[model samples]
Target: MSKKLNMSRRDFLRLTGMSSIAAGVYTIPGVGGVLAQDEREVTIFFWDGPPLIGIREKALAPFDDAYPGCKLNFTSVPGGPASGYNDKLFTSLAAGIPPDVFIIEIGLLPQFLADDLLLDLKPYVDADDYDLSQFPDLAIEAYTHEGGIYGMPDNVASIAIFYNADLFEEAGAMMPTAQWDDPEWTVDDFFSSCEKLTKRDGNRTTQYACDVTGWDKVWQTWVRIFGGQLVDDPFYPTECTLNEAGAVEGLQFYADLRWEHGFAPRPEAMAMGTTALLQTGQLAMFYSGSWAFPNFREVDFNVALGHYPAGPGGRANYVYYYPLVVPKTTEAPECAWNLLKFFNGPAMETIIREGGLQGTSFAEQEKWFVTDPLPPANKHVMLDAARHFVAPDPVLTNFGEITQIMQAQIDLLMIGEERDAKVVCDEIVRQVNPLIKEGQWRSG
Candidate 1:
């Protein structure tokens, strides 16, 4: 990325008549003016930012052409909820001028649904008698709440272990299988590999075996694999279940990976983030979702997806599934739905398949995702994961707030600061239960 030197549009246009663009189109590259202009412009916002404007523009071109009169006025907001995007969305909602359609992460779905901010897409689905069976069961269930459809599975990904094959070979550690049900790949095997793969330099580690950043996603996966859940119930949760023994055991295993076993790096020790550590052969294995595919695709080392080691719950993998949603406040409901329907089609799949997003819920697109001559000779792990994936993060009405409270405690546990997993888990419950009591999900 290069530093931006601000210049007015007038100055830019004056400097050059037109710079060449993709595939010989040499015009000022903007969005949503491919076809004739129309009055019913369906305004939309996505959090992908300006870097992906070209892809978004190309993906929505067919939609614009299909309904020339109902133009899709699109804007790319750079950040997810943490950045200015959701803040702008909430502000727009308050002003009664929210976009016709927008993007949101799965964690915020319950909040949006409980607040009655999403349109009941069931009417559109029923009217078309849409064969929603094509999507993965996880998606169909997650997007539908209280017998009403709110969104369609847009970008999807599942958690799995991505290991550096070369590092594993050099360490003489056993390579993990891609098969989901392989009894050989267990947590014990993973610990052995981490031991062998780690290297030391005079009490200062040179190469770390793995990383558990104690982020929201990583710890949550451990909680799920131990046959535990974060809440009593997803939609109507009254208490935090992380205080249970199963949850504590799961979290202790994660904490011990760094603090006790010395197999993984602590957050402060990692001068360069975990991804960089993996790319440079300092970190042997990375635990993350397919969303990391784009970053890892270009690395010099050979990357492969390992079958997640079996835990007490037997190889449970958590997926972070974000969907494209249409707001109930849209001026043109029909046009918004039309735009959303187009997003679920093939063009969008093509856009996401190039190391973009995996576990997209398309059974037929299996070959497209794995057929690439990439390092992961065993990419089918994704297909198996889709069938058996779990969404462990409790979807409460105040999910974002609850997550902040939970993460604060879990981070200490991940590091050496909090040795007792039960102490951290208990603190999470004590702080987060009140919020859940007031804002647990309710049927709209």
Candidate 2:
């Protein structure tokens, strides 16, 4: 392993001056990289909860047989980067005992690459003649930095509408189309259904139409679908473009769902939880990624998938994925590499089929995901959405800070504190542009 450089918080602040702070300062005092080099044990870490934890273990059981004499040590934390998982990983890195393999959100790729923590998998792929064409372009695109494949995504959790068929039927509202390119599945058509699905009891909503989650990707999809964009370019954003007329209009339309149209529930009612509401028939339509399946499967009602409504820019929605990586610091490189292959191969199948996750590989997705005879019987919906997906915001190392700035402003609109999307969009452009510029600044 090469020498790892430690950057202090002060150093990070001074060096970048952007709102970037690592989970732990690399300068923290600990034996940086002195793990036993002879250990045959390969450690893998994950961040998820519930049945997923159990399913992952079941999927991994074949590893021992796949690679004889390799001991596996696996641990999965409850949440994501904000959920003590980052703290634990960073602590392990500081002590030079980080897991050999781990899965992470795609957003964290830039930071990991910047810290020189992730191993470049190009050599392994080239040596073994590994076929990278199986996975979707975005899955590979998310983890490939400067042509070196640093990660392989276990699944692509593409954004799509998961609606309650029972609620739609009860209200006599037309159901959303499973096809992403369907011309009839427009926002106007969607809202028409929403209005029908909405029921009220003197200002109190007995049943709601649609509650579009204010996740950065979810709202941003509306921006693109409305023929607007958050940045000048998705791959290499030069400045914020969300203040444009289309972007503003798109955001305002969604905000209108709650405040103006009285379709979506208020924050108080939503606090009861979308999953619970959808399960109990209080909500007809809600937007979430394919990962929502496991939690939603518990629902007794009939839940089906719907693609994002088409708009001026066509059905442009976002997709995010979890990529498994082998850290450069792993002592057991061969075992870890084999483990990574296993993750992308067999483990990928189990994770998608049994775990209810959308697959990263397109063929695997069609064969496994599409064929699954489960609720949301229209399994092809997510696959279609993924095919017609929009490129996400530029993979900037400072993306977290950029999103933080955006969310802080956009929240006002979603919460009805600000009636005008233009105000929030303008504020985001003002705040996020420099951070986008800082991507080049950091690279320079």
Candidate 3:
């Protein structure tokens, strides 16, 4: 006979606590607890800067106007250098004092979701009378885990090619086009163009062909172009494909521009101001995420945008979706939901456009695109890049750790220490698979 299965009181309370939290209702004091006063205020904690500040403020405006005494208290957390934000956010959660709504970057979203720190906003989102289709399915899907919705997206970011038009003209090369997938005009064309665009001193001192400087960022682009991935699958921790033959080929291609072709600056030399290199008319091409648009525009040079050069796989690219998620410790679930919906609505168009963020909503993007025309290179280049970009699958947990592992091994390959790609792949799997297995997964 099978014995009756019963849960301990502590287990039951834990389950109940999770259920309440997932439902966006929690019992706490002052924070997510019941409001004693007649007028209620929602406290939101998030990063400070032009990109987020603009989005949060515009979204909360209509809510304040509609609800009268319902005010939004915006708290500014330390921003920049990533580590500061991560440490502070973790400390708050550990102290059981998380904000009602917070911004979650793609790289770190998995950590919070796995720990059940985020609320499932499905019910609120389902009841809202808004056009969810305006946003990409990829953006919505990124925040989802184990069949439940944990967050709503604020930005759909992709790595695109930003070139200096005046620099390109100086090199006497034509701008890249949508048919970058065509072998005749893609890989070889891109590097050859960079070679021509590269400038050198009379003493052969130094200058720039392309400012594709960052190690991990450039590797991600090349890995996809060769049809390889950092990990085999998001949910399963089986094997790593980083050292795959294809991936190695991709890395070599990147390294060749620096080592063999003598086009790019040496690693140590690029340590100085990179953007300044572009502004001074020393660099021709810079590949990076659309988030850098604002930073790049600050330069005195004329800028133009284009899609990342495609490979044999056809129009390969990478994107990141930053989500706006409500935490389980939220004091006002209803108010947070109301403000979140408004943030993703029409009002957001103005905020995102002015802030120079490429968000998840096409309508909002189009609004920004119309007003802030792409500088000379290609006005519609952003839309073109969006067409083929692929973000990392969200099923992977502790994404920050995984990238760190991949990057460490990738550095070996980048520096010619690991000539065989398969060897690198094998070592990565041995190092990270156990960590993935030991991780606690929430009901996806």
Query: Among these predicted structures, which one has the highest lDDT?
Result: 2
Residues 1-444, model 3: lDDT tens digits: 999979999999999999988556434447343444544577666675756655656555667876655567776665642747657766777888777777767767777776778888888877875566676666676677777788777666766677788777777876666343445547767877877887677848355777545457567677677776666665444556566766667766776676666677666666666656666776676676566666665666778777766675455666666788888767678888876776677557666666566766777777666567545345455654554456455355665677677778766655656655566667776787775654436442
lDDT of 2: 0.79
Instruction: Extract clashing residue pairs from model 1.
Output: none
Clashes of 3: 6
Candidate 2: residue 110 lDDT (0-100): 77
Model 3, 335: alpha-carbon shift in Å? Answer: 1.1
Please report, in order, the local distance difference test score of every candidate based on alpha carbons.
0.75, 0.79, 0.66
Question: Could you tally the backbone clashes for each prediction?
Answer: 0, 0, 6
**Worst 10-residue lDDT window, candidate 1:** 26-35
For each candidate in turn, the TM-score is 0.86, 0.85, 0.82
Worst 10 residues of 3 by lDDT: 31-40
On residues 313-348, what C-alpha lDDT tens digit does candidate 2 reach at each position? 777777776788888977677788888788778877
lDDT of 1 by residue, 1-444 (tens): 999899899989866554433323522232222432344578788776533545765777678777656777877667556778888887888888788888887878887887888998999999988878767677768788888989887666666678899999999998777888888878888889989998999898888888877667777777777777888876557788889987888899889988888889988877687878888888998776655666776788888887667888677776666877888867678888888777776456655653255635465447555676765556777667776766635667678888888888887887688899999989988998898887765642
| Model 1 TM-score (2 dp) | 0.86
